[model samples]
Target: MSAPRVFVVENTLAKMAREPGGRNAEAAVKAAELRIDGVKDVSLASLIEKAEQLGVLAAEARASGESEAFGPVYDLSNAIYGVAGAFGLKGLAEAAFSLCDLTDHFRSGEEANWPAIDVHVDGIRLLATLGEKATAAGADSVLDGLRKVRARVMPAN
Candidate 1:
């Protein structure tokens, strides 16, 4: 039999990140969807699936008090930010990237540099909740802190 066909998700997040703000939210979303759809012809589907496995690894490291072993976890988060940024979702992207950096920093033998994981989790949850509220309010589209974030990431936009 021939090799099975695979899919790869496009990196729309990176594209969106470069756009920033209301100017490109819709385009970012649409591009993201298209990127997701592209996974049918490559290995991106497998790559996404691996995220679950990585989560398990991260949990194990955390449980074992081997926080320094979280480098891989940070890499994964950074990858997500790259896509988010491409899609003009700078707020979400930055948050994710920052979390990765913080995690890695603490994991790398840096004393007094540990981040508050709980706070990051709460912030992410709040952003999601706010996005839902905005959608409910019939807002055109909602990306929390994107307006401010975009200004920083894509100043020209």
Candidate 2:
């Protein structure tokens, strides 16, 4: 299991603390630091459990065949993206992001191919099973397969 990729973005709290004009800058920074610490302390077990639940939700949504299912599927994908990104599960995060986009397309009145959703759910399950042990190579392969499926379902305009 390679270490999860560390994404360093702008530290908004730190930036605000550095600015002279903001009121309660110190408190904001402290709150941000506490939030960071809490994220760091998130248990792998809990993340895995969430991932499992998401898989079930996605599968159920697919089975339901109601366009309304897109809502829950989108929400679950968002949750998976956040948790997976925090835990360095890059593949899972990427897959979830793709799934979110696909669901959004459907929500926007684009026709959805249910089989593609099934594939995405399978990819999420694979990442949940692999957890921290998931490899970038494996993730890339899965992403490639998903892209192929997406391309087939949604032909370029």
Candidate 3:
């Protein structure tokens, strides 16, 4: 298969560099570079493990009808978003972001679309297992699935 596209979001780095701190501009740039380097050093296996654990927690919370579970689920989705985006897992990142948005909407008194959240969780697991190469290879199909779920979960606004 062809090499996967590196999905670096330069804007994220820029935003990090622009964060308010007592440090000077050069120091901020250095900090941003270090953050990116740190992400490179992270093990993908560990990230996947964390995502799996979060997914299970989300499922259990949903099953138990715990409204408080929104916080954990939202945090899990954000974690997935960060890790996947850092690792260039664009499909997974998008899926996780959509899930995060859906959870936020639900928490804001919108109807919870549990089935759509399941689809996002499934996408996260699938992309985590497949990694970047397979994800790039199957980008079209993966994105199609995510888009369908997003449509279902998105509050009419």
Candidate 4:
């Protein structure tokens, strides 16, 4: 009920800067970006491969009655979600995140929403085919469609 004691913690990096051996955080970020860039091509290719695999898995899973296939889809999409932004694939990351959200929403059901699953996987693969700076016509429209489909499938409750 009294005035709280507020102990201010000094910015560690600013304190370090005042010292002799401090480094510019911006330079460190640039260096880190360069390192991550080294693996960008390989990572992008792997993501595409995973996206393709997701399509096949979704088809196979529905055929085999594996309602739990959303589990693997969630895992792969989550991984894609984690890294897609770092590589500047905004659409791909958005689709991946949508997929993850859809999977989570449908996971507890007795049957998975196959059409929604297919739409997301296809959307992801399509986005993966486009480059990071892709300004392809209707790209935003595609992203918008993804959001629409997610809404249609998993209506807000």
Candidate 5:
């Protein structure tokens, strides 16, 4: 297995951190980095170790209800989707995107939407698992998750 590419994720984090709402959002970015470390079929022990270093801080911020952190997470997560797409990991990418979007939706005024968001997050974790084992399948799994979210959020015509 090849190392997961960090190109998109890194840049995405930088961009997201610039937002006025990024103070809390930064935690999500770190959390997402922690997530990337766990990618399967890839020897990311080094990355995982790094994630461990930051995970505690990120977790604390999240637990503190620094809701602004949602922005960074969404940004980083979206970038992950793009990376997945570039590597033909559409399922994994889409699933990640779905979770990001769900988080955004919840932040943007859908306070009572965790049930749906939880479903999306679950799909994202599954896709991430796939990414650890099969990059391509993981990307596609992400795409599928995104589609599911879209189906629920998009207006029926």
Candidate 6:
């Protein structure tokens, strides 16, 4: 029996970084951050669209009082969280995460806390309206309110 020979390939990205004259890793990272920051406005557009869509869905769920109606809210909040976090919208990202946590509590328990969902929807909208300045005074207040709202229903853990 003959053993098959194994070939190892160096990662292209690693090789490029290690090669002489290659761009400085730190400089490349800073350059990428600048590029990402340029799209901050575009991220707000996305946040608006996502927030609008989530608002409608949450409103419907509140009206019907059906647990299943909020099913997609959790999934959509994940997308919201991703986009908000990627753009460094700290307040918005925190709000999205709180929504996700509240949604989990809503889904697990027998009765749904529709009002809490509404609170989160409103919070998200407020954060989005505050725009790219994640640390704005309004954003901080909204985030603080959301934390309290989510804390009400979330089981201590």
Winning candidate number (TM-score): 4
- For candidate 1, the TM-score is 0.43
Q: If the candidates were sorted by their lDDT against the true structure, best first, what order would they fall in? A: 6, 4, 2, 3, 5, 1
Displacement of the residue 142 alpha carbon in candidate 6, Å: 2.0
Task: Sort by TM-score, best first.
Answer: 4, 6, 3, 2, 5, 1
Per-candidate TM vs. native? 0.43, 0.67, 0.69, 0.78, 0.46, 0.78
* Global lDDT scores for all candidate models: 0.51, 0.78, 0.76, 0.81, 0.55, 0.82
lDDT score of residue 50 within candidate 4: 86
Ten-residue region with minimum lDDT total, candidate 4? 130-139
Pairwise TM-score winner, candidates 4 and 5: 4
Off by over 4 Å in 6: 1-21, 63-68, 133-135
lDDT of 3 by residue, 1-157 (tens): 8988878556887787678876887888999978886756455676678668768877776876756677788887888788778777788788778878878877777767788777777777777777665546586587788787787667357
Better of 2 and 3 by lDDT: 2
Q: What is the lDDT of candidate 4?
A: 0.81
Clashing pairs in 4: none
- Give the poorly placed runs of model 2, Cα more than 4 Å off: 1-43
Per-candidate RMSD, Å: 14.7, 12.0, 13.4, 4.6, 16.6, 4.2
C-alpha lDDT of candidate 3 relative to the true structure: 0.76
Which model is ahead, 1 or 2, in terms of TM-score?
2
Candidate 6 local Cα displacement, residue 76, angstroms: 1.9
Off by over 4 Å in 4: 1-22
What is candidate 2's local distance difference test score? 0.78
Task: Kindly state the number of residue pairs that clash in model 2.
Answer: 0
Candidate 4: residue 20 lDDT (0-100): 79
Candidate 3, 106: how far from true, in Å? Answer: 1.7
Query: Residue by residue across 1-29, what tens digits does model 2's lDDT show?
Result: 89888887998988876877765858888
